[model samples]
Target: MALTVDKLMNDERFSGDNVLQFLLYLPFGILLLVVRLLLALVLWVASIILPNKSGVRQMLSTLACWTFGVYVKLKGTRDPRCSVMVANYVSCLDSLAASHVLGTISLRKWKVPPFFASTLGIRNAAQFVRKQHFAECPSKPVLLQPEGGPTNGKGLLKFTDWPCPLGNRVQPVAISVERMFTNVTVHGGDSRSSFPWADALWFLCTPVTVYSLRLLPPVERHDDDDAAMANNLSAAIAEALQIERTEFKWEELRPRGRAPPSRRAGGAGDVTTLARQVKEVLPAVPIHDILRDLAKTRSVDVTITNFLEGVTPYTPEDTTEPRPSTSKPRYVTPAPTGVFPKSAKERQLSFQERKAQMIAEAKKRYIEKNGLNLALNNC
Candidate 1:
């Protein structure tokens, strides 16, 4: 079976890529098993000696340096060591790719297979945390996949009811998955799988699985402000990954009985959530450009100083007395003496020129989008 657009679009598990993967991996399964054992043994020993997250993280990061022919491109400053990495859940390969850049400690679900149990699992490097006690303390940097589970890596899931359990000093990370051999980007699909074991094997066996980690600036919390921190981090993550923020909770969006209170309150909560989530995450900070666009749309100069603080720096001018009719709302005639187009042919030329310019601008924008997607896919 040859890899085709039909298969990729449909995302069948037994696509040509998977067949190639099977052939590539089956021959080296034993070698991979041995390597996994060695890595697990080393990690197990390190974990037994180092009871804290920092020590484990240090060991894992060190190990990542020696293994895998993978491409790990990390972008951003490393700071606030005690910060939870709120990253997008792509595939099982996330930890290994992430481990290459920094030491990560996860307080996720405690389900590690028996073979690598010592190095992984609740009792190992990643502490086991139940839902009730997810983030009871801020003692260490907890690796959190706020999406609850994996997605297609192209979309984002809604942040759970409680996104920030570790309380601020939040570092938002987005890990984009791209397989070099086949252009099949892994995530949640039938032709592919999101299981950690499968992803790990792919990483180890494949020549180069590109993992682009974009670490946005950390959000510092002065007090117990979890909601603000979660919103800010999630919105930043969404924007960084080029995905939409799922603001409405699932139940709230479902068609049901009388709906919720906030729905009845004219979605005030949703407005507040979006406003609080808005803080510049774009490269070079295009807040000025955004404000300019907004001003043009509203026909009013925008003065939004602090987006995160939900502060509207400019208010619309009051029209309390209705402004006494202004200038009678009449169109003035075109200046006949100026260098304006006089003939129909000249006017047609001007219109065509403007039309061409508009088409050129549209093409430029479309090209930019395609380029970004290519970059995201690590092409």
Candidate 2:
């Protein structure tokens, strides 16, 4: 396990394709996108005369896999026959992965012009509401990331206030993503957090991504209480990813123990010796495969088990296999707006609370504007 996670992430070689992987698959991704567009147009025109439905959706699903050259393996039991699909969020690519097996993605909440919405099937595929409420199983199977945004794939974040709002009985789907050899996984905790395209680029540019689609046994309203069922489903996903469990919110899980600063201040350090020591404990599997499972599900509880405080310093030792990295775009993901969040409890705000927060922000802006106006008048 000399292959520390940080090294693979920073080495710059494993950033998806070498000259070959990109030249080979980037064209495919682009070509398939063109094909997808052309086919969608043809299907739209044909829908006018054709009595049967156009198969554009099925085509989109298939093209997603071909475009990336990255393989997808969807396992476990699933029957959209049950209605709604609840999934664990990892990357935005989860939708593409689902499209391979399911139909058109839920257009989400994008407000497209009427012309585009009709042609692209956005009108029929989208869903928007103040709150997700109880409903019958959707006939066409609606996919929802109840967690709202993506996570590191190590543990489950706090679920939005479902409380059985969107039907008490639901099928939980775990969409686990493995980003070959990188430590960072796809995530979108909030708008200020990370963008989907940026994460997708990092994933696509990486060597390969293994997606595990685990469809859990359906949890019915009558079978268990809402909280219990959610816990069970979350635990099932955690077991699949081989990570620990956490029911707490994102910011609540940082501290280790009630120890002095001298005792715990060294968490962030250049612990090469510690890296070597902890490397010994990593599972005796290929780092690539280990990363796949880790991306699928590595719990936050164990996120600190190996490294001290800061990331373990990494340096590559020459290997037998020839390297495959040169002139790739140096991926630069920006930091969040502020170095730290304004509040610990605000990360998981509810719909109403979020609206209130937005209103307060607007009022603050107006007050500042008026204050500046009065100051100018006085001057």
lDDT of 2 by residue, 152-268 (tens): 665676553342334566677777766644533422222212233445445444556677787777767766655666676666666666665555443332223334322455522
lDDT of 1 by residue, 149-255 (tens): 55555456566524464445678887786664443333332211123455455555555567789988887777645566767777888888876665433223222
**Candidate 2 colliding pairs:** 16-205, 16-206, 16-207, 133-165, 154-298, 154-299, 267-309, 267-310, 268-309, 268-310
Q: Candidate 1 — which pairs collide?
A: 12-191, 13-191
Candidate lDDT (C-alpha), each: 0.50, 0.47
Clashes, model 2: 10
Off by over 4 Å in 1: 1-70, 113-140, 182-196, 220-228, 247-379
* Reference-based lDDT, residue 110, model 2: 31
- Residue 181's C-alpha lDDT in candidate 2? 41
